[model samples]
Target chain A: MLTVVKNQILVCILSVKYNIMREMLNKVTFLMNVTFMILNNASILIQWFVLFRLREDIGGYTMREVMLLWGLTAASFGLSRVLFARVYSLPELIVSGKLDSYLVQPKNVLLSVMTSSTNISAIGDLLYGLILLAVCGLGVRGFLLSLLFVVTGMIILTAFALFLGSLAFWFVRVEMLSGEMVMGLISFATYPDGIFQGISRFLLYFIMPVGMIVYHPVHILVRFDAGMFFTVLGYACLLSVAATVVFYRGLRRYASSSLMEARM
Target chain B: MRRQEKNAGANVGVLGKREKYIGRRYGLPGRKYGVIYRSVLMENLQYAANIALGFFGYFVFIFIFIKLWDYIYQTPGELIAGYSKEQMIWYVMMTEMMWFGSNAGSVGRQVKTDIRGGNIAYLMNKPYHYTLYILTKYTGEWSVRLPMYALLAVMIGTMMVGPVPGFKIVAVPVMAACIILGLTINAVFKICISLLSFWIEDASPFQWLYDKLLLVVGTIFPVEIFPQALQPFFKLTPIYTVCYGPAKLIVDFRPDKCVEILAAQVLYLAAGCGLMFFVYRKGVKKLYVNGG
Candidate 1:
């Protein structure tokens, strides 16, 4: 089991490196893609700044906390895209029978398929998040905690997307549905958690799980809580397991295309 | 005698073909575009489920903002940035509806793909104007989508924030005109940006930047909410005419503001069309088709 885990990690790292090298072949376009993405991410902050101008805090979040939320959300989202970019395209792969290559591989299919692609522009997001973190004056301890939360956030996001994308197994045209679902998760995660109340709050925390992905993590970062930290970690594990089981189960239903194609 | 008659009939057929190619070119140009528009409308209606699914994202955004504003306006009848709580919620609903309803990004993406994938080679040679063809095709889609989204927005807005205060029924037609103009300006600008693909390696980043600007400046909040120093700058951009103008008019209609917004929209629409044609002409001159 340990050997398998090690192998999966090695494959993931190599896949990411290969993908990055491929994109970096065009250095100028790659740099522009990343730079523009960072600018794209930063532009949205104008709204928050405009809002904060009118009021001191939104949903009990100061400007600093909001920045932290935006930073963490961007960073985690970027990390997920950078590491598991293929997860977003899983529905397309499933629909087109492109998973045949991964199915034949000896490595873990989910991990192998996910890490086979990279979003180079997401590096911008990762950098932008760290820049925001530095701007927030995060100490070493807070920064470390934020990094931990980023991992958990990445896991939850990936798992949720995988679980949604896996639905393509049973349903036709599930790609749009899954895309919207994943988009909803990211969209909600960026908003202040305190604004949500009652059933909506419950829905965010449990049904969609943006709470576990971002809100809880940011909350814990604002004031460290060991119990919440463990809960988030546990939730991440639970979700990862759920998503993996779903994907493999769905794999049983996958119909391979008769068309032969070269991977390289 | 039979051969001569047949020859004359063939001559008439050739003349008709020549007329079609060089003369009226499928009757009135508007009618030609109308056919394209109707076909696209039919296609979108056939796949209406996909567009309907987009409402889920729309709902999430509107719901979040509703709650956010509710939190902000803690007291009853409180006004922030010249809008009451109800007006603010309605403003969000309206702007978000316009944003989601217009399907603005589709045109840009379509243009980019056509240019990059060499599909524009086929499209540019067609009888219709390429930009006009795209605008009509997407407008047909918007015609189908916008009404449905508008219905959903009204339902959600009324349900969540109870109607906008002092919303005059008489003002709705003017507001509708503003919305149509705003969406047109938006689509035109999107085309202008996408036409950049003819010059640049990638125009998607520009599209993203444009979308984020619109979202942050006008869609999420009114220009009034921005700092006084920046309001003029915001107004100078199409974000003012594209999103804020129509939404604000709907939420809070003043006759003077209505006239100002309509005039500005017309000016922007003209300017947007001028820019679109300028880019398209320049880009087409630079376009290179690699293979057959």
Candidate 2:
């Protein structure tokens, strides 16, 4: 068990390094991409700024709290994309029969597949999140707590994307639906939770579960609660396991195309 | 010699010289583009189900904004930046419809891919202008999408906030014209940005920046909401012509305002076309391709 764990970790590290090196092959473009992404993320803040000018707060969130919400969401999303970018492409891979390559490897197929690519722009997102947190005057303890929430959020998001992408095994052309689902989660996660009520709020928590990804984490960050923290962590673990089960079950339905392809 | 003479006469006698000259001079290119437009329109209609899936994102945005605005407009007839709550909601509906319906993002991405993947080289030898070909194809897609989104917008807008408080039925035609112009301006500007791929390795970031600007400045809120000093600057940008102008006209129709917006849109559309052509011409000179 220890050896397997070690091997997976090593695989993850090496995969990330290789992906980063590949992107850095064109250093100028890579740097420009990261810088532009940071600006892109920052540009949306102008909306919040415009809104706050008219109202004291939006759905009980002051400008600072909203910034925190954006920070956590951006950082977590960025980390997930940077680390497991291929999760987003899983549907295409499954549909095209490209998973044949991963199946032949001895490593954990899912982990190998997930870490096989990187989004260079997500590095900007990670940096933007940290910068926002710093600007918000996050102390060391607050920073550490935010880090834990970021990880939990990242796990939930990646697992959710994996679960959606895994549906490709059973359904042809599921990519559009899955893409919308993931985008819906990200979109809702950015908004303050106070605005949502009744059925919409229920849907967010249960059906789509943006609540687990960001809202709960933001609430805990405001005032640390042990019960909520454990619940968030537990939910992350449960969702991860559920997604893994679904992926492997769907894997059984995957038919290889006998495609001859090389991965350099 | 008799058979050859007969065949030549048969080929030459179909049209008089004047009619043939007229057809060649005026009818051919327009007919060709019209055919391209119709074919693409039919292609999109065949996949209408796939296009309808976009409503999920549209609904999510409108729903969230409705909830947020409900919190903002505390009183029954309160106004923010000179817009009553109802007008604000309707304005948001109109802008969101145009934004989603325009299909600018996909068009921009297609242009970028074509340039970077060396596909444009193949297109250069074609008789039609590349820019016009892209515009016509996208216009076909827009025609199929915008009406569906508009219907949804009206339904959601009415259901969420009741009807617009003082809307004039007579204004609908003018509003439709503004909407079409706004979408055209948006599509043209996107093509201009995508043309930057000729020099830059990636034009996506510029596209993102432009989208964000349009979203925040015009799509979500009108220029009046900005500080008084900034409104003039904001109006100067294409965001006003592309997003805010039409939505504002729809939500509050003044004849003079409509005329001003229409005039501005025409100017911007012309400028956008000029810019697109300039970039394409320059970029074509730099383009190099190897390996068929």
* Tens-digit per-residue lDDT, A191-230, candidate 2: 9999999999999988886888888888888888889889
Clashing pairs in 1: none
Which residue runs does candidate 1 get wrong by more than 4 Å?
Answer: A1-4, B1-25
lDDT of 1 by residue, A128-215 (tens): 9878877887799888888888888899999999999999999978898889888888888888988888999999999998999889
For model 2 the interface RMSD, in Å, equals 0.8
> Measured against the native two-chain assembly using Cα atoms, what DockQ does each of the candidate structures obtain, in the order listed?
0.77, 0.71
- How many collisions between residues are there in candidate 1? 0
Candidate 1 lDDT score at position A88: 94
In angstroms, give how far residue B15 of model 1 lies from its true place: 14
Cα lDDT listed for each candidate: 0.89, 0.89
RMSD (Cα, Å) for all candidates, in order, is 2.9, 2.8
Q: Could you give the DockQ of candidate 2?
A: 0.71
Error of 2 at A240 (Å): 0.4
True contacts recovered per prediction: 0.84, 0.65
